[model samples]
Target: MSDERRSLHTENVELQRRLEGLTPLLAEKETKLIKLEQEIEILNNKLKQQIKEIENLKINLEEKLKENLKQKSEGERIEQRFKLNIETLNNELEEREFFEKVFLKIISILKSPELTETKIKSEQREASYRREEHERYQRVIDELNEQLQQTNERFERLERERNELEIKIDELRQKNDILEMELELAHDKMSQQQETSRTLEEKQRELHLQEKEHRSAQVRAQRELEALQSLSQSLANENKGLREERADLEERIGELTEMLNIRENRVKRAAELINEFLERYRLTSGRLKQQIGRQAEDCEEFDRLIQKLRQMPIPKPGLVQNLRICGRPGVPRLEK
Candidate 1:
């Protein structure tokens, strides 16, 4: 009985020692949990900021897209107007060519002396009519010259407008290139953010698991503490049979301690890994932020470039000479 009481007392002392050791470990775990929670809160705040940034980026992209669509529509309208002007000019050129051919034919007929030699009264009458026709031709030639001058002026105006449109088109193309580059950068940033979010989610999940495990361990420790308290309360009455039971309980406690040590090591390793991941994430996020800032600057520069392009002067078309239709006096103009 004395030996059994001594063993029981020793078991109680060892249990107390283990309980004291576990208390500090639990406290340390609680400290770590709180620290982790604080860190998670910080990460959450960062995530929220990142989300806001993404939203702003989306808004900017939408505005840029709308601007691009508006520009494209305007460009199309300009192109259609240019096409109509070119067709009108082509038709005018064709009309001028036809009039030139007619003029050449009239001159050729006038140069044919055989018509004068025919000596028929009809021929003489025809000759008189031909002289009248020549005077009418002179009037027609003067009208053609006036028309030509007007057409030349119109052509010059159209050419100047076309040149201006071409310059605008080239500038639009450059803007498109800049927009495409900006879009690519935005896409890259979005991808990076997504990747970072995924990493954060994974880390959050790991933290949740660790919290669960810690809670379970805390519950188990509480249960063990309660059992030890009950055993202590019943020690006087049950001391005879408790020798073997105390040895088994001590063995179990040792096993629990070993398990806890293993768990602590695992927790340490997990914490190290988490810290490493956080460091990497921090570096990556910093780089992404810098990139985003640079992209914003680039966008601003692109806008400035667009404004400069808009302010640039367009080239004007010079006047072109009219097609000469009259020949030297008494000579026929040859049609090529």
Candidate 2:
């Protein structure tokens, strides 16, 4: 930015030199100076606008980056939560398997043939232990009944959790779809911004080219003015020859007029083409909603220029001889 400022300063210094060189030819130096000032002012305003746009784009990108980071963190947190839930479910399943094995073992011990064979040999011992055995069996049955109730409760809780997880999964799917749509919209916005940036860059390049061309034109105009001064001296001394030259000059003027008409037609055609492109661009933007206005943001300058041209009165006498600003499509330039 500083470099650009420096370059503009250099150009201003050069322009001052050129303006000094043209002072002798110019009858209204003060008026021309004021116009130059206005032109420079306009250019500065445009530069400021471009800077503002760049800043806005930077801010937008920063916001998008933050949003993406936030979403990523949220996704990671959800993933961790799911992992913990799965681990807890697996541990509960293992515990349930252990309980089933223990229950099977208890049933097998009660039905064993070894315990029954000892009944005949130790009838007195069996009678003495029978009450204890009955109490132990009752305790085992109570424990089995409690375990069964706990298992049933666990199963019911697991089913409830499974249903809840299903609901969460559905919610997550919907959120995923929403995020996808948001991503798509972000992509579209990025693309649109990129397109606008490219267009502005192209306009800047064209302006630079036009500036260079304008400088060359100034040099040519300076030379032409010098020639005109020399011719005036020669014409003052020779009447007949000067009259012939006057006729030739008139013919040249007519040709120039025709050339001007052709240029005007071309400019009108270019404007129409630009309008057509704007229409299509606007329609596309409208479908997406926002970004492109009904009357495009970039077209304001063009509209102003066109209206100014339309309202311009016919030049009279000496006004045609003076160099002045002529607003064209991409760049404004001096015309005699």
Alpha-carbon lDDT, every model: 0.47, 0.47
In model 1, the runs with Cα more than 4 Å from the true position are: 1-135, 232-336
* TM-score, one value per model: 0.32, 0.31
**Cα lDDT of model 2 by residue, 1-336, tens digit:** 223323433463454445444444343434444554555565455555555554554555455555545545554565565556556655655665565467446645665577655544454554446546556655655665565556556555555554554555565456556555555555555565556555555655655565576456434533443453354334334433433545534443344334444444444444444345335632342231222122132234333433443465545555655636455443333345
Regions more than 4 Å wrong, model 2: 1-132, 225-336
TM-score of 1: 0.32
Tens-digit lDDT string for candidate 1 (86-153): 56655655665666567557655775567545435554575566557556655655665565556556
Q: Which candidate tops TM-score? A: 1
